[model samples]
Each structure stands twice: as structure tokens, then as C-alpha cells.
Target: MNVSINIKWPLIILLMLPFTLAIGCLIQIKHFAPEPLILKKDEIFTLPSGTNYAGLEKLLRRQHLAKKTCWLPWLIKLEPKLAEVKAGTYRLQPGMTVRDLLNLLVSGKEAQFSIQFIEGERLKEWLTVLSRAPYMKHDLHDVTPQTLGVKLGDPADSILEGEFYPDTYLYTATTSDSAILKRARQRMKLMLLKIWEGRAEGLPYETPQELLIMASIVEKETAIKEERARVASVFINRLRAGMKLQTDPTVIYGISEDYHNSITRRDLMTPTPYNTYIINGLPPTPIAMPGQASLKAAAHPEESEYLYFVADGRGGHVFSTNLASHNQAVRKYRQGHDIRGNNE
Candidate 1:
């Protein structure tokens, strides 16, 4: 025998009511979940030091990154340490969420700005470039080189030129120009000390400063890496042989603010502190910034009898031990010949 029972629709509905309510609540929570912000472009967000949760909310509001302004204040209630944010410029991504942005700020991952001080650049040119770097804080306007040295804690009474190390320097947006220069200056000092300590014995250079001056000349002489030591050797040989350096770059440096073209015979005859033709030794100051290769070459120059070199039309140079051979190489290069001089 089969038995039949009748169930009311209202009873079934009543039983499903609690589950229905629970599903609706879940749907609401999912709707309010954190999501990527809608930004057309990435921006730099700055959270100053000691910013509290409320301050962060205001900043986020201005940046259009905040979805729910109350979320952070409540979040700080849960994780109190999140309230302590570091001060820095941060690269806020286009799709970054409030959570992601907050995490980055709390993590102290600041945006980095870089400035490259190229080798062989004059100190004045370097300063001009540094002053124009975007987002870099500057205080060097109208500051004399002497005052700059004092600000950088240098006790030397002489002017600081070619004293800054040539390298790519990383800094924060708020980093002062003076601070970057100070680090470069310190780096150069350390490098000079280290190189001087291990310099070749019997080098004619009486001091590290002289080595720097010669290194600057070598840096300006050639851009080819393999030629640095060779060029430095020629200068050293000339110094030892009691010959005037007679380098064109040194002569040009002597002309200073007046130099703008090929060296003239009159310029060679002119006497200045930096004129190697008139002065039988290294210039009183470095003519340009020397890189590590040049510095190392100056400190540990190759042993060679080469006393002269000229541009070989190509990037490399033609070295010669005698005036006749040097003149011949210069003529060959001027004629655009690919002749590798016998001195090589």
C-alpha cells in the first residue's frame, strides 16, 4: 500500500528564508570587496612622516584612490602599526588598490630619482645638469665652489674641482643637491685614497692630486677603454723625459672661458696655470672628471716609451715614440688611412 502526504508552499518558503537572507548578505560583502582603482595614469603619492589614518584618507581622497574613506581608520583599529607610515615619494600604480597603496606606503618603498655624472664633463656643466634634473631638490643656486666645499664638510682651502666621483647617483625626490654632491665627493676621496695606496712605485706624481689631474687629461684624451693606460703612459713618459706635456686639451683648459674652437698656435704660446705647453708638468687642477679606468691608469700606468699620440680618424689613437713618427701618423690619419702605426 502507498501513503500520500500534503505539504504547504508557505512552510517550504519559511524553511528557506534564513538561507536566502544568508546568501543576500554574502552578495553584499562581495560587492563591497576591495578592487583596483580606476586611474588613467600612474602618479607619485607622498605620505609625509607621522601621518595618521585620517590624514591618509584625506590624501587618498584627493588622489581618487580611496574607495571607502572609513576603511583605513577601522583598519588601524585592527592593526595599529599600520598607522605609522613613512615619508617618501611612492610610485602609485594605475590599478593599485587602497590596500596595495597602504601596504607600499607602510613598507617604505620610496620612488627613486637618478642623475648620471658622466666622465670628462666639467664641474660647471655637471652642476648645470644637476640643477635641471626633474623632481630633484636644489640649493646650489648662487653657491660658490668654496662655500659648497664648506657645506660638504671639506676642510681643504683650495677650490674643489673634479673632486666628485662620476657615476649614476640614486636619490629620493626630497634629497638636496648638496647631499648628492657630498656623497659623490666622499666617494671620490675614498677612491683616490685606495688607488693612491696601491699606486705603482717610482711614479713621478708627487701627490694624489697630481694623479687626478693627469687622469683627467687621459679621460679627455680618449674614449676608448683599451687606450686609457696607453695614453696615460705617453704623458708619464713625457713627464719623466723633462718634455712639456704639450697636450691640446690642457692648452684649451688654459684658455678657459675663451676656448671654443680648434687650438691655435697663439693659445699654445699663452701661459696659464693649466697650460701644459708653458708649465712643464700636470695642470694645477683637473680639467675634467675622470672615471675609474682613467684613475686606475693614472695610478698604474703601462710601462711604455711612447711619447706622442694623435687621433687615428677612427675612435682609437696612433702612438709614437719620436716626433718624426708622430708627425707621420698625424698625416696618415688626416689622409683617412687605416694604418695602425708601428708604435702600436
Candidate 2:
């Protein structure tokens, strides 16, 4: 009987050994799961592509985010979902626990970044903004106006100015520059189509492109919300009367990179496709990006006989129906500057 009891006791001890170790590991995991990590502030963590659970564990240990412990491996083994971590940039907040971090990694919600394309800015300026943005992939190294226009199904010689909408766009890390530009372009197209369909009747514009050109001019003319429609009316009246749309913004755009801060007489007289002083109608292309308000104003201009406008020396403009009145207003505000009837 004593020998039999001794053999039974040994068997019982062997059976209980794994259970005891498992209980100890469970206690360690519970303790580590809720404890705050050793982070003082927000931290940006990047998990490289093709990284697995074991690799992440090693990285956590190396970064001192987690203590070197054997129980972590046991926790991972118990929760198989923890092994599935998505590769992307993540922002880890303070007081986050191991469980929270694991959930975030497996959820695949990467940190988002934003880039803004502003109104009245040129495409070159927008490209510069994209190039300086953080975490963006510079895929536009060989991009030009001609190549980009062709890629967007426009003619190879098509001008890409004012084709993209000016707005803030959000994207994940490593988003290509071309991707953002394409989205902006699509948005602009949709918005332009919508506005063109709802355009007011009897406007001088023959095509949506011509309306876009006028909108770009209005956007550059006055930032005042009330003045946009009035400004559009002036250009439309000029187009109807066969008079020159003598705007300074077009002259500046014609001068291109060589334009100084102020427009000179030489720039006004120089013959270029964009120089409204020389051109009889709208410029061949838009000078800058136009926002929704300007586009809408171009589509639906105010009913007015104003043929000219000059800066009021304030933030607004003085509109006139005749060149004599326009010259008088220009002389009143401009004082000693050129006696040009249009806003310079």
C-alpha cells in the first residue's frame, strides 16, 4: 500500500507542474497588460514592412518600450491576433499599455498627415508645398505641366494651371504626390462641371474652359466676397463689347518668373497670350487656382453695366461704366501712378 501511494503522489506532482507554470505566466501577463509604458510624451513609431510578431517584440525591447520578459512571448502565443501587426506609421500616446498598443497595431489605423493647396496659388507653389510636406513620397520629380496634363487625359500641350482644386487633403504616410494631385484634379473637374451646368444665361463664355479662365481672373482680382460677382460682370461686359480685359494679374502671369512685385508699362505692352492688355478676350489659360466662390461668381455674374474697376485704396474696388469715369477713379486712388483705367 505504501509503494502504491508513493507512485500516485509522483504522478500527481508531474500533472500539476505545467498548470503551476501557466498560472504564473498568467499573473505576469495580467500585471504587464495594464501598466503604463515608459513614455514621457507622444511618440511616433514606425513598423517596417514584412515585420512579424517576434520582430516587433525585439523592437519594443530595443526601444525600451517594454521590459525584456519571457511572459510577453507567452501572452503573444495565447492571443494569436497580436501576431498580425500592420506595417505603417503610428502615433503612440502617453500612458498606453501593452494591450492598447497591440490592439492599435492590429487595427491598421495609420497616422494621417495633411497638405493644403491654397487659393490664388500657382501649380508650382502647390508642388513646392507637396515637396516640403513630411512623410510624402516625391513621385513628381520628372513631372511637368505637359506630362501631367497628358496623364490626366488632356492634350500633351494642354496647360495644367487651375486644373486642381485648392483644399486641404489628408493622406497616410508615404502617399505619392501624384496621388494627391490626381484627387485635387478630379475634385476640381467635378466642381467645375457642377458650376458650369448651373451657370446663368447670356454670359459671353463659349466653353467651360473659358469660364474657368474668367474665374481665375476674378479670384486674383479681389478677395472681397461681395466684389467677386461684380468683378466677373466687368470681364463679361468687356468680352461682350469686344473691349480688352486690361487686368494686371494676366500681365503678371504673362511675365512668368521674371515678374517683379509691381507691374510696369513694358509688361502691360508686352505681347503674350496671357497679357489681357494686349489680348481682346480671356487669356488662353488660367493664371492661378480659383476657389468655389470665384467659380460660382464667374458662372453667375451680377447684372451690371460696369465696364471698369480700380482699387479703392481700401480692400475694395471702384467700378465704372465708362473709361472717363474709370480714369477719374484711378486718378483719385492711384495718385501719381499710371492713369490706366483698369485695376493694376
lDDT by residue (tens digit), candidate 1, 1-344: 12222355667788999999878755543433355765778777778777777888788777777566655666656567766678788887777766677678779888887999999988877888888887778888876655666666667576687899999999988888988888898899999999999999999988999999999999999999899999999999999999999998988877977887778888888989988888878888998899999999999898999999998787899999999999999888866653444435
User: Highest TM-score among the candidates is held by which one?
Assistant: 2
Clashing pairs in 1: none
Best by lDDT: 2
Per-candidate TM-scores read 0.83, 0.88
The clash count for each model shown is 0, 0
How well does candidate 2 match the true structure in TM-score terms? 0.88
- TM-score of decoy 1: 0.83
For candidate 1, give the lDDT of residue 40. Answer: 73
lDDT of each residue in 1-344, candidate 2, tens digit only: 99999999989999999999889878888887776777999887889999977788788888888764445667788888887889998888898998888889999998888999999998878878887888877877766665777756678888899989999999888688889998999999999999999999988889998999999999999999999999999999988989999999999998987897988998889999999888789899999999999999999999999999999877899999998999999888867344444445
- Report clash pairs, candidate 2: none
